[model samples]
Target: MIQQFRRFCAGLIVSLSAFGGFAGAAENADLLLSGPLFPAIETFHLENGMQVGVVPDARATFVTHMVWYRVGAADEASGKSGIAHFLEHLLFKGTEKFPGNAIDRTVKAVGGNHNAFTSHDYTGYFQKVTREHLPLMMEIEADRMMNVDFNAADVDVERQVVLEERARGIETSPRAQLSAAMDLALFKNHPYRRPIIGWRNEIESLNVDEIREFYERFYTPANAILIVAGNVTLDEVKSLAGKVYAPLQNRAPAYQPERPQEPDELRMRQVITVRDPKITNESITITFRVPSFRTGLPGENEAIDMLSEILSGTTRSRIYRDMVIDRQIATSAGAYAGSGARDDTTFALYATPKGEVTLEEMEKELFAAIDRIARDGVTSDELDRARKRLFANAIYAQDSASGLANILGRTLIVGNRLEDIRSWPDRLRAITPAQIQAVAAKFFDPDKAVIGLLRRPIDFETASLKKDPA
Candidate 1:
């Protein structure tokens, strides 16, 4: 994973340098258009009710084909926490027409790769191959749209795999445990409180029938979006998609009510102690509820994003500069704002204090930085630097076929148009210093934040002889 991440970062840096020259022009165009700086995408709906979006970039011979299902862990019914994720795993097991290892064998034979991921708002499966294989990839994805074969034995095997994943991801890590607890404490009735991997007992008890039911309900053409990007013309993609995906009939969209709003946090703090011999360090996480990408108005979401960047987008960010570098109180510190499809979101700060530097000291500095931003607002220079970093990162993302597919699918799934994906660099460039400050002041309130600490257990001695004499 670390190697993969390093490769990804390296590739991003190269792409950013190459694309930097286009930033000024893109920003100017965005200002004139009132939204994105790029031309509109060619979007059309198939007779089967599938929405297809094409962004014809003929820069390379590679094409990215993605099928995005508009249901994720958030759409799981009560007592069905991990069904969505389980279905994601099962899709690769087999299908009616392709059966067994057909997808893997064929993709590899054609010099292509395929994968999928499940999030709170959506699940996506994609493949990247040469333009010549676009039609074959599309047909393979469409074949498994609703033709997955789920057996009881397969369910049992995958369930254990998920359990092991949870153990590695949450159970064994103190930080992960604290994060899960914080999420539960943060939301009272929202499904976001449930982990995307689902609870252990819930996952263990889930059967084949439940998984199949979820697939039938949410994996319909109407609830899915098809994105094809690469060295292909819009007309070619449309014609191929019509032939491949138009056969599936539509189904009624899933209907769910709005997520219940979380009440204002009067005062909440949690301290979790883990007893593991291997544990030698402690960490802290502070989370603040903010607006989701979908709920906020145009540019509103960007403002919060800019605020997060200003706080701890990089080593030069305020938190890192103050706590990690200047004072040397923390080993590492950073901030994150989750851009998802819900109305409410979280802005989190994660830190690992230096030895003998108490979590209290770390929390003090973290809150102080946020308070300063809320009071004085960020400077124009700080905001501009953050914006430039984001723009650079966005440009860097254009190199990877998988990254492009993810960006398009995620933005569209969250209710934004596909055009927003191309114009994101321009939008990041246009955010003003004052706008970042305004959002910081509104959403960075201490009262709305949840502070959690993970630490080793404290030792205590108890009386013995004195009590016996009494």
Candidate 2:
């Protein structure tokens, strides 16, 4: 297992190890192990306002070309929810230069792959292909950047797909339902409260012109990030981009409208419960609104990242060890810090009870664990372990070209600097126990939290047995 993990990282790394322009060399071992992630990545901007990040990894044969637009579900016009996501589906339908799925078919013909996704803060598209096909990828992407051509019929077809997706993903799944409810509770005024997939009724109402208008508004050179990662150099990528992307004009506003901010004070704590007949596992989630990397003070985001690692990043982590192994009240327990968003992010804790343990029992233990961490702070040993675990994960993530591109693109689009990503190791290492405790005590206030319980209907087991008994 260890060897396989290394292989994946190394395979991914062979591409990423080149980010620092080091490639895989015995001479660079110490630097590779100790230095910042992507130590040598090159970032620049076109005259047209498109930002570019180039990570050259010669160990890999192909490059992962990614274009990230600084727009997503949160940026949608009010009542036009899901239009951002809906447009992601339609972009592939056609473009003026390469219409009718020609771009996708062309990539496959060359044994390459392509896909796109939309999120709360951004939308992105990527393709992986050999060096020889790099310019081809750039050409088609640049074409679509300004020239997506979808008809009304295409919009109708894709709208139904989005609606069905919401039905299948949000309405039918208890977990998704719980998450949506929690977000609505956690973010009262901020657009973050809106689901990325949009509300079902709004999705149904989304029209063709809305999709076209949204695409034209947000898909500008200024609002996009072009990331080229793999066995390629800055000069090669720059040369190709100069030909393909340089001519594109910026059509977006000089400044995007500011997102609505969450109020300074949260007046109440919210507890939401969702009981689904199909749910077999009962779990509770406690989420607190916290500052994202962009909004956090110096060392705040890093400390939160460390706090989450110490809490439940591994099986040996505090929450897991205490709840699942020592107390034996939970089948699973963990906490995560969402430090990546453009605005405020989240720090969440969740646990599933073992056997007949009540959600109330699990909730009590979970909150106590968080309280203990906030009050006592982590020991030096715990701090050391967490730093190592987080650093190791960072190292592993750096081994893939696509992974490097994702980290670079996502960080850039969310109003964070490239140095913020490159300096992650040093920042993570610099975090102290007191800093972690400070964020813990500060963000996890009960008055500002959202708690969710998802479980089977009250008599689900009884009903199941009554219906199936022989």
Candidate 3:
């Protein structure tokens, strides 16, 4: 049973290890992994300024369509915190052709799933269904593009729903509280500090007209990108897009508001801690202010990604092996970097304290691991293993059309080009251990980092979970 569990964990590591530049060269092509994430992706613009990216895959049967709007929580004005997310919910309420639940009912009737998400830099809606339903998906999305409407009743109802959602998703969780406070310390004046869900006070003030104005402002064809991946041709998607989205004239503003930059003094450091009975083990996370894929140097972004993987991509990774297994201080350890945001990115590492292991000790050990990387740099063997896992996962991701589609959509929304996707594998191979260490030494400075803790109160007892018993 132990060996079986280890095998299962090993398989997950092989399959799930991935990064922004994960895709690799085709099979038997000298490189370790298989073909590119999307071998051929064609992009074109409609007359109304909607950008469309089509990735053709013969192996895929169904199609995945994603529409990315260039506005999200950060775009909301000072007073209207949650309006962007509220508008996202309201969009589904109804339109002239597809009234309340009509669009959802149709998609369900066709046996498809559809949903939307609001993020710090963008809002997106995605649907995956049969190839025959592609036209209907585009048509309904195009309809909502210009025709969504809501009455007073709908507005009040959704407002309450959004508020209730906030209570469930954020307010009730101690970890969420720590995250919010940590960001507040991390970004200072930057809009990224504002929670994606907005504050309860601000959300209460969100009304129909406010959301309508915001919708009219940012929800234009020019400010959106459409990504379609499936067993389909570029010409078919282009023809369908021309028939549906071509007529939408650009109504969005010509100038985007330049968000306030994080002050250099934001180069400062701080710590935040939250306590709750619900949380037993002490949780600690260290976050650094980093650069996004577009904002950072080309090789630098990929290097940061590689650095994260080498630090803790799996159970065999440095932090887990050291802090969790060898030191027996932390019950769990992991690290990840988000390279998709527009203005900046965040690279964070987190761990939970094992029984009788103080949070302070765990924090010290975590930094010590980071310090070792900066001082000695990584070995070629470690780098090679990390790259292999990365390359392998990229090959595996090819089997999912929606996953490829998401890569294209997220890449474009964060201000990268289509060619970036094509060149991902090449760029990743170019990242050296020196480059990884460079990011480590540069971004891991204590001055520019934020540390957050989900500390447990004295006498708090952890639930039925062990601390690296293996």
Candidate 4:
């Protein structure tokens, strides 16, 4: 169970693919995507209000289909922290029409791949199969959407599975523990602080009634988006969707995402330290709250994305070159701007010290590097290299049709339009070296930071990491 969960989080599937463009915008998506007509983007809505998006790639004979539900960790009821995730597992358990492993058996027999995933803002199920099997994929997905069997025994069985997942994924690892602690300190009132996997106590206590209510509420047509990418046309997709999905009623409950609002995080330097016997390398991570794609201006997301690359994206990155190669204070150092977020996001910088180098020394050196970037700013050469690399990767990403499908699914799910997904390169290209430095100085404030340490228990004993805090 632990091994399975580790692999899941390690790749950390974020369907918010951030990949290629919509082949052509559907007529309905033109108003929603809100821009000039794009070449291959096709978007529409079913009679029942389920938004459908198509990205045609004649290059391949296979297709990737995704159904995204607008419910995730942030949408669960207060005491039922893991219900959204639990439902993701249970949804696969069966429905009356596709009873008892039928979905899995059929997919395996067809030589297709299928999986589901959950994140802070949404849960999604997807299947990839040859173009000829697209309708069959739709039939099964559409059937399960309306007829999921929320059996009591299934709930109890999956509850234990989630507990095992949490234990293996979070409880045993020092880094995972540190990351969870950092989340708790980062968001004040937002449900983003809660682990998408849910706490063990909450997972154990969640019952069938809560799961059923959640399923009936957030899994409706109005709350779902269907994304198809491959050798197919908008017209064929519409016809198929009309037959398969249009039957599901577009019922809007009184539920609008009533998530808690997070207050301004004004505190300077919150800290969480975890001591575990299994921990080998002592590490420190610094997280700063930043604007998400949904809130930031067009250029802001691109600027920060470039900023992460310029800071610590490669061996040539400033932090890596300075600390790992020149100064020899750490073995590795990297910076990242969190992606696929609906609300606010965090910018993270992490490093692990080399032998005989104290974590204190590593911390001082790491901060000095960030402070230098904030103070003097970065040069055009560094900026150009980072920008070129980002664009190059974006171009490379377009090769995979399924990859592009994943991107479209994530973009639409996160309250973003298809136009911007198509225009991602222009935005990244427009980001200036000054803008990168500006976001650096603006977001990397020492006062608005959460510092977390994952250290060996012996080191904690010698140092001052005395007590564990809630």
Best-performing candidate as measured by lDDT: 2
Candidate 3 at 144: error in angstroms?
0.3
- On lDDT, the stronger of 2 and 3 is 2
- Per-candidate TM-score against the hidden true structure: 0.86, 0.90, 0.90, 0.89
Q: What are the Cα lDDT values of the candidates?
A: 0.71, 0.79, 0.77, 0.74
Instruction: Tell me model 1's lDDT, rounded to 2 decimals.
Output: 0.71
> What is the total number of backbone clashes in candidate 1?
0
Candidate 4 local Cα displacement, residue 278, angstroms = 0.4
- Go through the candidates in order and give the C-alpha RMSD of each one to the true structure: 5.3, 6.0, 6.7, 6.4
lDDT of 3 at 102: 96
lDDT per residue (tens digit) for residues 1-470 in model 3: 00111111111111234433433432322264434445677899887778899989889878998898888788889989988788888888879999989989988899998998777777888888999999999988988888988677898998889889889878999987887887788788888888888999998887778888888889889889999999899999989999889987777753264798887765777888888888867789988888766678768877877787888877778999888898788889978777666776577888898888777777788787778888999998888777776766676666777877876776777567877766667777788889888888888887767889887665423332354334
Order the candidates by TM-score, highest first.
Answer: 2, 3, 4, 1
- Tens digit per residue, CA lDDT, model 4, 1-35: 11111111111112221231332321233234333
Error of 1 at 465 (Å): 16
